[model samples]
Structure formats: C-alpha cells, structure tokens
Target chain A: MRTERIGDRGDLHRLAAQGLLYRTGPFVIRLQTRLREVTDTFARIYLGTEVLEDPRLAHFSVRVTASSPLRRPWGAQSQFWIDDIPPFEPYPRTHAFPLLEWGINWCIGTRAHRYLLLHAGALERGGRALLLPAMPGSGKSTLSTALAFRGWRFLSDEFGVILPGAATVAPLPRAIPLKNRSIQVIRDFAPEAVMGPVFEKTRKGDVAHVRPPHDSLARQLENAAPGWIVFPCFRAGGTTAVRTLPRSEAFTRLAQNSFNYRLLGERGFLDLTALVRACACFSLDFSDLDQAVAVIEDLASSA
Target chain B: MSSHESAALTAWRQPTSVRRFTAEQWTDALWGAGQHRCLARLSYRIEDAGCANACPEPAWDLLTSARYYPNFLQVRVAREIRHLHRILRARGIDFVLLKGGAYLSAGFPFARGRGMNDLDLMVRRSALGEAEAALRAAGLVTATLNDYDQHYYRTWMHEIPPLHHPERGVEVDVHHRILPLTSRLNPAPEIMWADAVALPATPGVAILSPPDMLLHTATHLFYDGAILDGFRDLLDIDSLIATHAIAPDYWSRLLGRAASLELGRPLYYALYFARRILATPIPTATMEEAHARFAPGALVRPVMEHLVTRVLPPRPRAARAAPVSAWLLYLRSHWLRMPPGLLARHLGRKGLRRFASDSPAADWPPP
Candidate 1:
C-alpha cells in the first residue's frame, strides 16, 4: 500500500526534487510531479499546512495518513499518511501530501489584502492578457495549454490576480494541473511540452502538471492589459466555432465565474464590467486542438 | 421631601430599578441603580434576541482571535441576519430564509459557529413587486443603480439589486432562482413552494425543504466560484448536514426535484461537494445512483475534490469530515438542478458577452 501525506517534513525534499518550487513573495508550492498532464505552461505549487478550511478557499490544506506504503490507483506509490493541520502550525505525524493549493489561495485572497484574487485562468501575449473563465471541464486548461505552446505567455494557469487600480493581469506563473485525458491530449498536441511525472490515483483522477513556457517565466514580473475574455468549451465531436457574446451576459458570467467579484463588490463589478466592455468576448467550441489553436491565432493576429 | 428628591425617590423606588440600592451619594446612587437594571435588561434582551446569541462561544472566540477585517464582517452579518429576520417578520411579508439565517433558526446548534454574510430570502417571484414594496416600506431599499443598471435588472437579470435596510444596515438579496435568467435549469417555483419548510422561530416564515435548501446552497456556491466569503458558505453546508438527518433517498428526491425543475448541473456540483467535504450521510451507492441521472464530466470529480479539500476549514483530528461530505451532497444537488444544456447556454451566453466587440447586439450569440 502506498501512503499519501500532505505537510510531511520529508515531502519538501521530494517536491524540490520534482522541481515544483517557485518563489513569489513569501510563498512557495510543491509543484505536482506531472506538469504536462495539465498544461504546457511552467507551473509551480506551494504546499502548506491547512491552517483554515473556509469554503471561500481555492484549495484545501489536507494531510493523508496511510498505515503503510500504499500505491495510488493512478500508479504513483507512497508510504506516508496525510494529516491536515492548522496553518502556521508544525506538521503533524501523518504520511500524505500536505497540499497548500487552496490554503495559498485563501492566503492570497485574504492576506494579500491589496489585489483582488480571481478564479479564472489567465494567459498573455504581446502585453495583452486574456482571461479564460469557466467552470471545471470547460477545456480551460486544455485551451490555456494549447495557447501557451503556441507562443502565448502564461500569466497563470489557475488564477487571474487582477492588480488594484490597473487593468493588467499580474503574472503568477504556476503549474497548470491537467487531469485524465487532458494529459494525453496535451502530450500528443504539444510534443515538446516539458511535463513532470504523473501522480496517479490520488484524487481528481490521474493528474499531471505542465511547466510554463520559458518566455512566460522570463516575463513573470510583467503585467498585461486584459485584451480578450473567452470562454472555451470542448465538445467531444463539435466543430470549431467562435461566437461573440453580449456585454450584459458576459458581465453576469464573469461575475459568476469570478472568485472575488462579490468581495470587490462595486469595484469588482466596475472593473469586470470595464474589462468586458473593453475586450472582445467570445465562445469557442472545438473538438480538435489544432482547430482551436488556429482560431485563437487568427483572433490574436486580428487583435 | 422636596419635589426633585421625591421624584428621584419615586424613580429609585421602582422594583425594576432597585436591584442595586446600596450605592454612594443620592444622585449617583439613583443613576447607578436605575442604569444597572436597564443595562442588565439590555444585555438580557441581546442574549434572548433571535440568532444573535446563537453562535457558540468557541466560534465567537475563534472569530475574535483573528484581526482580519472579513472576520468582523462575518460576525456582523450573522448578527444582522438575526435582526433582519425579526424586522422582516414584523412587517408581515413572510420570508423563507435561506442558508445561514435558516440554519440558525432550524435549531441547529452549529449555526452560530458558521460564517456568513448577506441574508438570503426566497419570496414568490409574482410578489416581487409587492416584496420590493414591502421591503421599502420596512426601510430596506435597493442599492443605488443608474438608469441602464435598473433596466438591466428589470430586463435581463433574475433578481433586483440587493436591498439594504436603513435601520439594520445589512444587505439582503431576495432571489427567485438560484442562477441567472439565461441558465437552462429553472426549477419550478411551485416545487420550492411545495417543499417549503416553515421556520421553527417564525411560523409564517418558511424555508426551502432540506433537499431544496441543500440544492440552493450548492447552486449558489458552484455556479459562481464564490470568491469573497466562500469559507463561510462552506461552513454553512457543514452545519446543515451535521444537524439534518438526510434520508437515503434524499439524493434521488433531490435529483428528481431538480430534473422536474430543470436544475441538473447545479445540483450535481452541490451534492458532489457536500459528499466530498462534510461526508454527509449520503451513501456512495446512492451518490452513484444520483450521478447516473446527472452524469458529470470526468473533470468534475477532481475539481470537486480539489474544491472540497480546498475550502474546508482546518480543524483538529477529532473533527469529523462531515463538512467536506456535506459539500458533496450540495454538489449533487447542483448537478441535478442545472443540466448540461443550461450549463452550455450559460457558458455560451457569458462567453459571447465577455469576448464580444463594440457591436454588442450585432455580435450577440444565439441562446
């Protein structure tokens, strides 16, 4: 049996070996081993103690404890139990991956106290950022991965942290975790995409992370004005198509998809409305990655 | 005795004001004795007040320990819910309170510990005009809105701008449907009306049934990535599950109810999260049964897991996994509530608008 543990003392070294660490201010995350499973962008994750479990968090801090070495159904084997503990406290004696994704989201969302932390995934090109806001399985990661592979700079695969008083998306170049078939799809589509080892059968099916493109990493400090807001849908057999949406509908959707819109309240509403007002909004449906890529390329070239 | 002294003695002689009679100088003694009972009565009034004292000491202790601004907002909102309920009921516009306020009034002990903001109420959509009128009559007015904004609400949106009571100063959002107007799933108001459970505190005021209540809670959280105060919402789910004795057929009934109303996906998300976090009494086989009716995508499971684990508050080892599990129940409820077609429409409509260029109407996507 393989054990999975979060916040285990030895997990740090293991994560470091996996090249998941990326320093942004005082935070760092253990990038999931399989980066290619999610996106083509270079992504890093910070593993931390689950200090507080509030529903508003992006991820939960969890500790899993296994009685002995256990093998995950997805194929990664572990020998640890995971136990979640309060944030800032010492790691408990559990032997599981002490995840810090949601905990970090809460920290940034609340503690950052300056910028509004959004839930949409963001990518940039030519100093222009496009936010891909959708519910899970909307092919957001797949689209973001495809775009990054095609030379678009990866701002973030998970969050679009809009800086205060600016319309630009501050780059938080983190690993995008792709799941199940998305892993194989991205691998076949972007052959040169550098991906970490796959962690199987833990949760969310077999999961992998994709490294952000080097260009995106290089421009991590840069901020890009939001130029486009597209909601991508991956229909199994649908033909590729892009349709424009109305501002009112877009405003509602963005607000709904937004992580901090309500927190931003009037400001969130104003900023999001202005963003949609200024940007070209669209709905893209594609069964083929190449077709979707082509459409985005065309859209970018035209913009 | 002189008139002034006589009046003072008379005032002091009242039994309610004479509890602390052994004070200093006569004037000081009178004031202290008179004020002590008033202060005590005020304290007693606050203690006996609706839902204000509903929170447990530990939760209050935890909240005060944190100097975070949002924490203050959380407690203030909880207190406001108690106050808002009293005022709304006094006006005779019966309300089926949703989420935090409902849970607190449902005899759930943990309601006090749960974090919440913005009181949610469900009123008949037909009565929207009357409801708005009543709210205004009771001093709760809509937030400021420009002409275009008012048109948008009246024309496009499902509900009006959140209402704020002048006296209570708490924002209250009166909702008809869980999702926006464009969403495909529209659970019939009659079903909500049928399953409407009366509040224990106020007989005239009723709430959505347990399943419906869970469904609504999930829809609210999953449809929009609840960013601002999601932690509080998660806690509400935890408390609801911990207190309610949800039946085995609850999932099926919820799914059936959602299907009847066309709210599939929203219910699925709700049930999925409720089960994952709170580990609410939902049987796995039942969950599978429910999922068969409203099959979620492969991506949803992992995302659900990620979300449940992510949002659940950190607790000690002895703390039950009920909160995480309860979230899954709501996820199931959300899935059943909003089917794929509706999810697609919502996504499509939203995408077109956000990505549309200057030619708004010309570029509008077909629903």
Candidate 2:
C-alpha cells in the first residue's frame, strides 16, 4: 500500500511531479497531469495517503509522485504520476490550466470574509483595478495579456476577486495561459516576456503560459480599488472603440456572465451591483491590440 | 472423551474461544482497516459547493459537508430582505414576497438546498412610486430606461426594472402580476392579497398559500419556457407537496380560486404539468373534471408533448439526425409555449412600440 506524505518543500516538489499535489494561494490552481516523464520543466507527481489541514495554509494539498515519461512525437512529454486519482477530462483541451487555477480559486474564495471570487481577468494601473470579464472568445485573455505587456500591472489573468466591502480588488497574480495564435502574437509583441514551453494538443488547442513581469509578481499582495468594468469583444478587422454602457445594462451583463452570481444569490447581486455603481463601465470593440492597450492605459491613467 | 475429546483438546490448544462477529461488527472492522479510506469515504462530495479551503482540518472538514453555498446565500438574502422590508415599511408601502425568498420565509429551505437567482416581490400598482422610492432609499439603484420604455414597463410589464443594491449585487424584481407581458389570464392582484400568509419563519416577509405557491411554481415552469436550473424548482414543488400533505380538496379550491381570479389559463397549465411530470397526487376525477371545464385538450396536449420533447430531448450523437431533431424540437417547443395568437400579438406590440411611440393609444393593456 503506497502511503503519501506532505513533509517538506522537497516532498512537495516530488508530489507535484507525480501530479497528485496541488498548491493553492500564494496562488490558486486545479492541476491534473500524469507523471510519465520528469524534467526541469516537468516534474513527476506522486499520490500519497495524506490529509493535511491548516487554515493559514494555502488551499488544497494532495500528494502524488512522478512515474515515467509519456511519449509524444511533437516533444518530450514530461508527465507527473497521479496515483489514486481520476484522469484529466478538460474542455476545449487547453483549458486544463485554467480549470486547475479555477479550482484553487474555489478553495480561497470559499474562505474569504468580504470578497467574492468572480470569473474575470483583473489588471491594476494607477492604484485602480480594471476588470475585463467575458465568456470564452470574448477577447478578455488576449486583451489582458496585451495590457499586462504594455505595463498595466497584471493583478490576475483570471478571476476578479471583488472586495466590495472594502471597495477594492485583491491581487492574486499568476501565470497567464495564452492559447492558439494569441500565444505567438504575445511573444512577438512583448519579445522579452518570460513564457513556458508551449504544450500542444492536451486540451484547449496549443496552450502556453506567460509569467507575469517580476514587478507585477512582487506587487501580488497589493490591492487595487475597482475603477472600471469593461466587457471586451474582439472582432477581427474592426476599428477599436470604447462605448460607455448604462450601469444597469452593465449590471445585467455582469450578472449573466458571472460563474457564481446566482450561487451567491441576493448578496452576490448586491455586491456586484455595488461594484458597478462604484465603477465606470464600457463596451469595447476592437481588432487592434495596440490601440486597445493605448486606450486602456489612458483610461487607467485618468482613473 | 474419545474422538470428540481429542478434537476439543486440539481446538483448546489453539485458543479457548473464537468469537463470531456480526455483519455490522465485521463491516466496522473492515472500515477501520484502511488508513485514509474511512475519512475520505465519510461524506459525499458536492461538486458545486465553491469552497477551496482544504486546510485547517476542522474548518475544511465542516465546509466539506456544510452545504455552505446555499447556507451562505440564505443568510445574505435574509439580510437583504430585512433591509428591503425596513425601506418598504418606513415608506408605509405594502409588499408581498415571492419565489425563493418567499419559500425560505415559509420554511421551504431556499429552493431545496440550491441558491436562488434573485429576490422576487410584489408591490401594489398604486404604490409603485413608494416602493421604488423605498428601494432607492435602501441603496438599490433602479436601472435608467428611456421615458417611453419606462412607461411601457410600468404600464404593461409585470414588474418594475430590477432594482440593484450597490454593495450586495442583488437584483429585486418588484412585480404587480404573476404572468407574462402578454398573457390572457390576468389574475386580479387582490386575490394574492386575500390568501397571503405571513412567513412563519421570518417576520414581515409574507408567502403565498401552499396551493398558490404550488400553482406559482408550475405556472413559472410551464409558461415562461425559462428552464435554467429548474430542476431545483421542481424539487421545491415536490418537497412542498410531500411535507404539507395537501389534500385532494386543495386542487378543487385552487381551480375555483383561479376562475375567480381570472387565472384559468395559468392554473390549467400548472395542474396539467404538475400531474404529468411531477406525479403530484391530485385525484384523477379532479383532473378529468378540470380538463372538461377548461377544455384545454385541444391546445394543451400538443403544447405539453412539444415541451416534453424539448425539455428532455434525445441525447446528442455524431449523426446529423440528432442535431436536426433537436432544432425541430426546440422550434416546436417555442411555438407551443406561446400560441400563434399570443406570439403575433407580442411581436406586433413590440414592433409598434419600437417604430411608433407618439400615440398614447399605442400602449395596449397587458394580455
């Protein structure tokens, strides 16, 4: 009988390689990978029989160990062995990282006293957080990636943790996962951005993660008051324009797009309503990234 | 003391006695054998609880089985309702609670353990001003609409523009009627007033009678064709009936109540579907009698069949047939939910409202 243990940093690394242990907050994640291959880039995760409980501790700790390498033609597949766990079944393929991140978010979100975890990419500039929340393909990630590169301090690439009680956005910055052609686009645009190796064809086509600038990482503990709520739509070849939307309409749109708005029920509604009331809202339609980034920067600077 | 004595002596040499364990004891022993299996298998996991804190063993363990999402939501909604009640009372405006909050106040447990979407309430037509003002005073901002549109909502729609609280992020739909913007079954608002019962669980928040609540749930499910997270609502109806043990006479009283209130259509739809889908124990004779009086068979059967197909369509497949069939079923269901006459009237009114807004006569009374 294989018994898993959570002892030290080395043990944590060993378990992470096996795909059985997940680290939450200092970051948030919902990781599920097999440990078939091990490398500097990929560690083999192991499964262990351990139950850890600590409040001031990060959310979610499951032990796993690395096994052997999973062979793939495109690249050496670094696999983590996740024993006694279920296989990874993610939607759109590349969504594995986001799903894991969301799971970690669920952990911390469930514990907060005043903040609510919202599904949106948050970025801070000039002491204010600009929330870009939208459904998939709504160009939120792309816009967030662009804005972060252009010096809008990245608060989070996913999840806008709205602290309506304090009227602020708490920062939980981590690796921003960019998918498909957008990956290359960001790489070319930034030129100096630190990004992870591109993993092809697991889920959510051609996925890669870009590490936030060191400055942004350093400021991860900083909080920004939410200043603007923008619903971004990416239309190829369309002119970039920002239109002020009615607060009421924006409220409705935000409610509809939220993952746990209904789950939070009346409080969720009231919290979101307060958030929109305190913030200016707009609908931005743009095909050009540079123009969008400039307008966002200007907006942030003004705020 | 021959062969038997020899055997007994051999058994005694091994052990004096071997206790035979019962099935229950054996099960307990088995469970105790595993290291973490007992702890892991102690409770069923709720997939959508939305808590991620897997530390602070006691807190994490409590949250793991705590029904925290709905419980947290219930507390939040209760607080908001208390605030809303204060505002309404301060202004001397009367209000009636509806749906989830209403159910909670009536001790129905907030949509059978699932969180509700928004707080629903009804204010009298004459007191819309007082109600709106009260909500505004309570920090709920009303959505600004164009003057004409605002007038339309006030005049024809069942509710005012949903009022939102800035910090709470909750929407409150203040309604004057129970049905659609264009439904023929216009029940008198006063009827709900007569049967309205104060929530036993929460003071100042009034809930509809069991029969009315049941009818409301059914009408909502059948008429609106809005079935997002409706399984929870259906479960509400089931629990309400089972717990109340509502009598057979209740159905007849409901039918009479519907007729007097001029809500025959909504009532008929509710009873029909409640019996069909939920297997609510209404007497067959009552259904048959109502069927004869309402004569809904001509329209109801096809509508129900269409809805049944749409709501529970065949599983998706690789073949084109499945997709095509689903599309057709969806169209059919939409048509059934709204008859051609109602649909035509709705579309026509919408078009007229959009294109021509100068004439006061253009504003038609709600169907």
Candidate 3:
C-alpha cells in the first residue's frame, strides 16, 4: 500500500495535478497548490498524518496559487480557492501558508453545523475534555499549547467541536498557531515542543505553528465528554483569580463565542444547555503561564 | 423530457428515486439541486421519505450544510417580522408579507429552502411613506444612490429603493405594489389586499389570498424574469397547486382571480410549464380551459417554449444553454417591463455608462 504521507515528493506541479488529501477531524480537505511555500508548510505541519487516496471525494476541494504577475508586477499576491471559486481577495504571496490554514478553518467553521463549533481551544485529561472558550487575545491558545505540551492531550487549538445532541467533543488536533510573543513563550515554557519555521510581516503578525504531539495525532478518533468550561483572560501583571460562573451565564457566554450557535437554532440552544449543565464553569484571570496551567490542572483533577 | 434529463427531475419530484439512486446519480442530483438553490427543499423532501438515513456521505454533507442557512434565515425572518410589526402597528399601516417571507409566515412546506435576499412586505401605496418613515425610525436605511438612480426608483419602481439595517446587515424591501408601475400589465394593489389572509402567528402581518398568491408568483416569474430562481419558483407553483387544489372550486376560482387581475396569460404559462417540467398535477379541465383562453400566438408560443424549457431547469454541470435563447428572453423581459421610448433611453444610458467605465483607468492610487 502507498503510504498516506507525502514522503519525499515535493514537486509543486505534480502535487497540484495529483491532489493531496489531508484528513482533519470529520473533514478530508483535498488541497492543490502551485505555491512552493504552501506545500512545504503543509508537509511540515501535517508531518505524520495519513493522506487519503485519489478518487475519494473530499469535503472541501481547495487550492492556492500566485496571482498573475502581468496584472500587478508591483507586489506578488496569492489567492485561495474553494471548489474553483475565490471567496476572498488575494493576500501577499508570503501569506499563502496562513491563508491556506485560515481558508480551511473558514470552510469548517461555516459548513460544519452537525456540531456546535465554538471559537475556543480544547484539551483532554483522562478522556475528559476541557473547553477554554474566549474571544481572540484572551490567551486561550497560549494556555492550551502549554497544557498540550505539559500533560494534557490537545483536542484542538481553535474549534471546540461538540457534537450536536450530545456532550462529547471529537478531537481535531492540528498545528497550534502561535502568534508574535507567544511563539517564544511556548518555546521557553516547553523546550521539547517541536515547532515550524516562523513567517513574519503578514497579517496576525509574526506567526509560527507548534507541531501537535504524536500521541494526540494517534488518538484523533477519540471523543471525550466535556468536563469543565473555563473562560480565560490574560492580564499582563495581575494575580491569578478564578471564580465559579453560574450555568446560565456560562451558556450565554459559550453561545456568544460559538461560530454556528444561532445557525443551529433550537438544537444549538438545547445542546449547549445540556453541555453547560454537565460541566463545571469558571472564569479565570491570570498573568503567569505556570500559575494558569497549575490552576487549570487542579480544576480538571477535581472535576 | 429526455431520459437523461428526466433522471434529475424525477429525483426531485419523487422521494423513491433517492432510495434507488446510484452513487453517481446521487452526486449528480445533489449537484443539480445545489445549482438550482433548492437543496434545502430537497433535504426536506428526502427526509419526509425516510431517505436521509440512507444518504451517501456527499449527499448528507450537502443537505446538512444547505439546510442550516435556510433554517437560520427562517428564524431571522420571523424576528424581523415581529420587529416590523411592533413598529408599524401604532401607525395603522397594514402590511402583507410576500414571497419567502409570506411562505415562511404561513408555514408552507415549500418554505424549507426558500432563502430570500430581502424581507418583502407590501403596504398600501397611500401608507408607503409612513411605512418608510417607520422603518427608518427602526434603523433601516436606504443604500446611498446617485440622483439619477434615486429618480429612477422613486418615479418608476414599485418599491422604494431597498432599506438595510447598518449593523445587522438585514435588508428589508417595503413595496406599495407588486409589479413595476411601468410594466405592460399592472395588477392593482387593492385587488390583492382585498382578499389577503392574516398569518396566525403575527397579529399585523398577512399574506396574499391563495389564488392571488399563485397569480402574483406566476406574474413575478414570467414578467420580472427570475433566471437563477426559476426552478425554485416552479417548485413553489407545484407546491402551491398541491396544497390548495384539493378544494372542489379552486381551479375555477384561480382562473377567475387570474382574469380579474389581468394575469391570465402568466397563470396559463405557469400551469403549462409547471405541469410539463415538474409533473405538477393539474386537472384536465383546468388545463384545457387555460389552453383555450390564454395560449399565446403560434410564433411566440413555440419560441417561448424553446427558451423557457432550455433556461428554466438548473443547468446541469456538463451542459451548455443556448446563448441566443437567453439573449432573446433578456430582450423580451425589457420590452415587457417598459414602453419603447423609455426602453430606448434606459438602455442607451446604461450602455453608455458601462462603456465609459470599461475604458482605461485614469491613474493608480484611487481616491
């Protein structure tokens, strides 16, 4: 059998024509790109993952390539495509890898209504999941990455995929996108963390991706019941403060943080209510990574 | 219909076709339904038949994703209607919801996948300005348009230029009449509201009466020319017929209402095409009467048949439509929309503006 990994083949034309399927969670994205950086980035981040065979229909067929130089020679651009149609304006050529990552995220966030998709980071301990729901710049990613490298298995750094009509969350562990200073934070916090090359000067300034541990990738099929919900906030120099949140307040905050909460209508309301009822909810404010990790670990153990 | 053509349509009209669908056939049907923007309706139809459990992965994926947006819109439309009703009740502006808003308000089966670009509500022309003021006070404002465009809408269009909520991104179109004021056949708005039916869910909102609703749908499709939504409109007609034709006197009432509205010709075409294309059940006597009373002249009838059939169904993925047919219908729509002198001025100005815009850019770094 031909192995799922790309192995040694790195030719752009051949990859685009043949198509490479990267299975992520419930979705298998058939990605085709003529940009060298995008293929290289995909190869690096999705290092040990299986590549699905040809002729199997993918959930999303996407591509990224350079914009025509003749149109605008001043600045090179790369466009992301979904099913042959570009849904967004082209970005600078150096942003192709992030563009691809974001485009796939967009595809899942918009299309996958079978689950209640929250814009939150998730981690698992002893088959129990912890949902860290917060808006951007809330340090959810930083804490989740630290926990993933420490003892907890990473479920996902972006989406908290809670299956509709159930409380269990399916693991979709992919690369953790570390932004700006957090890139160095993770490197120093967990010296064993394997990360990719940093790409700077693009949107979401100075980003790199941390490779998910081999054990997390090995157990991608595992589904864990959500045990706790933490609303994390990072203050630069504040002491650690954790408070129990009322279930009703947690439900409202979670729905506000979800991508498809309103889209799922009554099903979303009922499912989220059930999830909030099952899990212990908290609001944590901390400045130190070690303190935040220790507090979260204690909470998970008590739950 | 050819055997190949019937494969897709058959899948749409009957649920059993889904049970027997090969993987390729299922993929093609899903693709065709998506192209026609009727996947939500297809989802409901298949689920009703208990075929959802057996759907192939690709079909299941398409159906679930397709169903969510329409369901979301359904909730939004309801909320928007309630907001509008609260705002307009004190002003005594009686408004009747139309199209998707109407179907959803009345809880019709065809409302399943009927996504709408705007919420359409028709008020009496005398009350139009008050209704506009009410919507404005409720935070719905019109998009900024140049003077000439504003003049065109205020002077000739049936509705005020569309209103949109700035923060919510929800569009609401308030209409005083159904057709454009300058169209060849103008149905009086009073006749429609005369027999309107109130929606039980909301106090102030109503829908056109059953017969008037059918006539309005046919006139809108035939006269306004809905190319992208042609299939959905036909499906709507089929659903309407199926829902309402059980009354013993419905056919005669429908014909009489169409005649009274000066819309017999459009109704005749709607019935003819609905029956032929979708296998919509039409009584033999009704079909015979429509043919005798409202069939077009020989030359126009054959030309319309060729163009309508070719252009109506969602074009299959591998198929190509005849360009001349679409072009002829385009001209026909404009001709039906306005008189010759106004048509010439409108087309001339539009063409000149398009030409000018297509010319080379003046310089880089646009202000």
Candidate 3 lDDT (Cα, 0 to 1): 0.83
Give me the displacement of residue B341 in model 3, in angstroms: 2.7
Residue-level lDDT of model 1, residues A1-303, one tens digit each, is 433323445444444334333444223332333323121222233233221211111111122222222433343322221112244432221212323333445445544433555567788877888888888788888888888888788877667777655476788775677888999999999998877667676346667777677676556777889888787888999899898888788778877886666655455666776777778888788889999888988887785
For every prediction, compared with the true complex, DockQ reads 0.01, 0.06, 0.36
i-RMSD values for every candidate model: 19.0, 11.3, 2.5
Chain A TM-score values, per prediction: 0.71, 0.74, 0.95
Ranked by TM-score, the better of candidates 2 and 3 is: 3
DockQ order, best first, reads 3, 2, 1
lDDT tens per residue, model 3, A148-236: 98889998989999987756998988778889999999999999988878979767888898888888887888899989999999999
* Candidate 1 lDDT score at position A225: 91
Higher-ranked by DockQ: 1 or 3: 3
lDDT: worst 10-residue window of model 2 chain B: B33-42
Q: Give me the candidate number with maximum lDDT.
A: 3
Q: How well does each candidate superpose onto the true structure, as a TM-score?
A: 0.41, 0.48, 0.87
Instruction: Sort every candidate by lDDT, greatest first.
Output: 3, 2, 1
Reference-based lDDT, residue A140, model 3: 85
